[model samples]
Target: MKRDKDALTLTRRIGVFGGTFDPIHIGHLVAAQNAMHAAALDQVLFVVANQPWQKEGTREVTDPKLRLLVVSQVLRTIPGLEPSDIEIQRGGLSYSIDTLNELRASHPNDELFLVVGADAASQMPTWERAEELSTLARLVIVNRYGYPTISSILDFDQPILAEMPWLDISSTDLRERVRDHRPLQFLLPETAIEAIELYQLYRNRENG
Candidate 1:
């Protein structure tokens, strides 16, 4: 039977995985899968942030449209996962507070689980409207191999630590590899790699 794309509206437990997704990699998928299983989420929303406020001016990211396309393409290969254009549509720098608020408004009765890396969780105290995050959605801190298990850093009391294997792949390193013409082999989805090569993405930082 064919699954309905709009069925996310009826979900009870949602996992919001927001990222630049410079190009959706396997690590992103593994982490989301771990979070979904650990939290028993109804579905995971892979939101592509238009402008990552944290990385702003520090590094270069692929064009928003290309990033979104890559994320959307990989998402279709998996069930129980969907790509969201909430931040891209909203425009400007993406903020967790804003995304959570919008989702809460749309899914008032459903429970929202916001997925974050351990590093991101550590800086929650300084986020815009940080205190209100717990009210908007339960935070799930995904574990990394080197980073300490650190959900308690925030005063919010509800952040749960998801102890999952750390997939050492990162977008920054991935981009560097692309610039160096390194083999992407198993790092990212085959289709995504083909698209990147076909379009010559990341070969030139500014253009990428």
Candidate 2:
């Protein structure tokens, strides 16, 4: 697929993949890559959330700097994977609507696609400024474990939803496996797993 150019003459067929990315893992990369190919995206921006409203005060995330470093390292091996600090620099409750709006302003002529897991997609109606968000970009939902009815959540004709293969792996599961001293050889990207072990993250947190 040919990439659309931005006002600055840069490639602009970008896909936005936002998440805590407390520790970037294989599952996250898999979904992003799959969506990139399936949607014919030229670039995929991995937006690491500084603070996620969904897990507000309930979960402890690794420092944004560390998270950003890990994300950068993980994406270094994957072509077309770019790490974005939009949410981290904004600092506060990171809302999808706000991020999409910012992207729209930055790339006015480019088309934006938001990639999210099925569980989050199922709860789109309850999101802040959800209706406005639907108009901001197309939502590409990836099926994950525990969220089987993703197709039923589309109440509007906007925010086109496309289904992809289900990836059962999750950061929560990776954390638990680490805490239990279990092997995570295939569960996450080698670089990501190395970073997790080096940082010793998610060892004390309970499974989500």
Candidate 3:
């Protein structure tokens, strides 16, 4: 299988972990770490979506600049994690295939793995240009708690299943916590919390 091909001479093994990341939380960090370690990725890029298509028309999303700022602030303290604004720079709806294509052109010799949650992987067939997306990079399906069971029928290249400890946290809840002036002490990184406060984000908006 193409996904299983030995990368004996690859310059880098980069994992693309794309998300709306309206607010990047601890769980998001944990999942990225687990995937990188399990898949032996050299670096994991936290690709912030400019406008998440699925999330569009759903609720108000934090500004991309603020979201990217928080991500950069938090990731700066961590090694092996990188903040990318490729999708944000592209502007408009952020699609996985488009991101991968840009990455492919930029890192021609690197092995690219598209890191996604198991729940998201199950819906791979419905993504924009699904068939072509499958060929752009190998898949790393991060499994957590096994609640939303992924069907055994997803046809993607060299799908690697990476298990992650389930964290009972969500961006929605985090946003609410901020809005209510509740303690976010242990929920988000201090840097992220500081950045949020510095920008006065989510202080006046209701969760969508």
Clashes of each: 0, 0, 0
Q: TM-score: which is higher, 1 or 3?
A: 3
Model 1 TM-score, all chains together: 0.89
Q: What lDDT is reached at residue 192 by model 3?
A: 89
For residue 61, model 2's alpha carbon misses the true position, in angstroms, by 1.5
Q: Quick one: ranking by lDDT, best first? A: 3, 1, 2
- On TM-score, the candidate that comes out on top is 3
Best of the two (2, 3) by TM-score: 3
- Model 2 poorest ten-residue lDDT run: 1-10
TM-score of each: 0.89, 0.86, 0.92
The TM-score of predicted model 2 comes to 0.86
Which parts of model 3 are misplaced by more than 4 Å? 1-10, 146-153
| Residue pairs whose backbone atoms clash in candidate 2 | none
Model 2 has an lDDT value of 0.79
Q: Given candidate 3, what's the lDDT at residue 76?
A: 97
Across residues 39-99, which tens digit of lDDT does each residue of candidate 3 receive?
8898999999999988889998888988999999999979999999999899999999999
Tens digit of per-residue lDDT, candidate 2, span 57-138: 8867778878998899899878999999999889998888899999999987777888877777877888888878668777
